[model samples]
Target: MSATQTAPAAASPSPASAPVKNSRGRVILASLIGTTVEFYDFYAYATAAVLVFPVLFFPTGDPLTAQLASFGVFGAAMIARPLGAVVFGHFGDKHGRKATLVASLLTMGIATFIIGLLPTYAQIGWFAALALLILRLAQGFALGGEWSGAALVATENAPAGKRAWYGTFPQLGAPIGFIIANGLFLVINFSSPSREWFLEWGWRVPFLFSAVMVIIGLWVRLKLVESSAFEKASTKGAIRKVPIGTVFRHHWKELILGTFFMLATYVLFYLMTSYTLAWGIKPADVETAQAAADAAGTPFDAAAFFPGGGFAYPEFVTMQIIGVVFFGVFTMLSGPIADAIGRRRLLIWVTLAIIVFGLTFNVFLMSGGSPRFAGALAQAFLIFGFTLMGATFGPMGALLPELFPTNVRYTGSAVSYNVSSILGAAVAPLIALALWAWVGEPWLVGVYLSVMGVLTLIALIIGKETKDVDYEEAGFSSSAVL
Candidate 1:
């Protein structure tokens, strides 16, 4: 089943439903837009978890404890993700990808918007914390269903030999969303009259702004026709009554391999964004923090202070934005390369690079030598790390769904991605933070990343290449059904 021979068949319309024919541009746009909103809402929360949530939601005497608790709430959402996957995956596999994508986007947008309006711990007491956790769970659940649908929208609609290339469009959403979310925060942080002003109101802006983004995303998605793959599945009477049962019963190997396959990507993503931001902007020494606290008429606890890169918020974030540019570039590049070679082969090499990158964390992060020298090294670390992030991430959009038939694809891919979130994203920030706090350095966290990368490499070794999957035929041919 060479791709060229099967691709034309995949695109041919069925008599069951007249295909509205999602145009090339429309397919790319719909795929890119939903995930963009998802990530924007997500990164907004991640950023606040570092800058504002600790002080506002999880206030405690010990800075480390407050941060850990804030991140604990952050991780809690990852736990809800798998459930979201099951619920949404069920509907998506049964109903259609278009409606499911719209539902997921709306869920996330509403949750994020309400979080902006919720009272803080000072105003509403622990209820504020409870509300935040519930909303975070909603956000997680929405995202659990969002990625796979978008990936399917792109890859399922893609032309032969170019599935991976079209897949890159959805992956592009991450860097774009990161830049937009953080860039907006950076702007608000700079524009506020004082740090107090920013803390009081500025952080809420990004969350509330998501409503507008959601409206635009919904419009784009509503315009999308069902992907050809889903139509092919449906027209052939392959739609399952319970996709979850079908997936677990028959595609158990894919579920397991796909979960571990995504392990390193999730770990690296959180580490590079959340953990790095937390560590990148901290005061390098207790004396500096105490001095700032004294000037601001705030109490300082020396016991809770930990050294970091010593860079200011603006300076460090600016560097991160620069690194993410390379992320976007390499993400786009990785797809074409994967299309030329194969997903498994490219990923194996990239995983090896990640393993090597993990070992060099101290080389870039150790806070010695002149401040200028240190800043240069930190910038290099971000650039290098995100470059790897893009390479590893881009192929996943096509690769994951290609592992399953169209009938169970929504369930299969979503389950794998979000389940891995529990293993990787759910804990990476906490683990990195704990190791950083315990050892007073970031080298151990890097070692953690390397270990995860090794796990991904093993998954890659065991998995088969799917560049030539006949998506049209993969559905309904299997006799296994629940």
Candidate 2:
């Protein structure tokens, strides 16, 4: 059957029938709160991996090598995400969305809290790195399950004609989480009397504070009922015994299309946040700066001549926070726009915008001559890149869930979302770093991003527009054999 076909009469709900609702506000709140905590935990680790983990976790060596190793640990979480999806997706589809959401939250929160207490290399040698790896994997695993459940909860309970808007509630978590995570680090970066103190102990505060956030998230999530859609499926005996297997056997096309459709968004997100942090804070290359100055017959001022020297960590993060505000705003706006235009159309236009942004993104970064200029350029990149990110990411919560039947929605969506992380987000920073080091060309990274955009644009062209699809009926009449 075609993806856009209506469900047959025996299984599908009538178009005139009202959608069942437990509480729309409660569902959106539960999804938003849980996702905010999940992303907060994830972003905290990303920030630390860039700023502190190299010095604290790895052997003293070339800073570049150590930074790569830290990112490798970061990628470890992304690698484990798919496995988490499979495990949690099984229970989420077989049992219920509520219980699965609660379990994933606890797993992520405990792992983040433990990371705060872990010993550094000086204290425990290689064992410290090993322990860090284990905790990071736990985090990835939990997040694997968290996002799909949150998206489903919001979309499934959403009123007819408003799934995209409701879906943005969960998408809202990305910027909010980034702001909280970076805001905390910014506080620690300035509050400490010395850099050593900040690196050694101050960084732990955010990770440790995750314990409180997790409790709050759980409280909010626990208050939610299972999604109305899932409840309906269960009542009708539509719930699958092995959701993952069913997804692979029946929805493989959507699984592949969804993964590639999200590739550019993931790539752009990590590059903007993680790789930008790495690039901005790296120490000035004095030799290279001197060469350029001598060749131009201008006196070398270390601050003005080197790109890295011009960027201060606190100031850069503050700029990112400002940009993230716009990201959140646009994220909210993208939903209504998708409702009006269509998810596929909105995605195509925004993705094309990303390709344009990617081609010129390096120009802004390379144009930094003074501290003021550098800060302005950084802000420009963040605002522009994140605007596109918001538009592309906002509709995803609705789009992915709409792609599959209700019986396999959680498993299909979770696997597609997490599997993309492995292909895109898991190694994006690592790949960008390698490109920066090997070719010493920032535009190459832009080209790389554009390539991902092209892939996603193609996926969009080949995929159906799902904004008008009836979520209530799409999943109930699947043809897959048991």
Off by over 4 Å in 1: 1-18, 283-306, 474-482
Tens digit of lDDT per residue, candidate 1, span 1-482? Answer: 89999998799877776647889999999999888888888789899998778767766657888789889999988999999999999999999999999999999999999999988776776788999999999999998899999999999888889999999999999999999999999999789776666666889999999899899889999998887778888988999999999989888988889999899999999999999999888653446434434454334453354357878788898999999999999999999999999999999999999999999999999877999999999999999999999999999998888888889999999999999999999999999999999998899999999999999999999888888778766465332211
lDDT of candidates 1 onward, in order: 0.88, 0.83
Model 1 alpha-carbon miss at residue 324, Å: 0.3
What is the C-alpha lDDT profile of model 2 across 1-482, one tens digit per residue? 65556456556877779654567668877899878988888789889987668767764455567778889999999999999999998999889898999999999999999999998876777899999999999999999999999999989888788899999999999999999999999988778776656756899999999889889889888877776667778888888888898899878988998898889999998998888887776443445433433443333243331234246678778878888898899999999998889899999999999989989966887844886877777788889988888999999989988888888888888999999999899999999988888876678888899999999999998988888766765354443211
Which window of ten consecutive residues has the lowest lDDT sum in model 1? 473-482
**Off by more than 4 A, model 2:** 1-21, 282-309, 474-482
Judged by whole-model lDDT over C-alpha atoms, candidate 2 comes out at 0.83
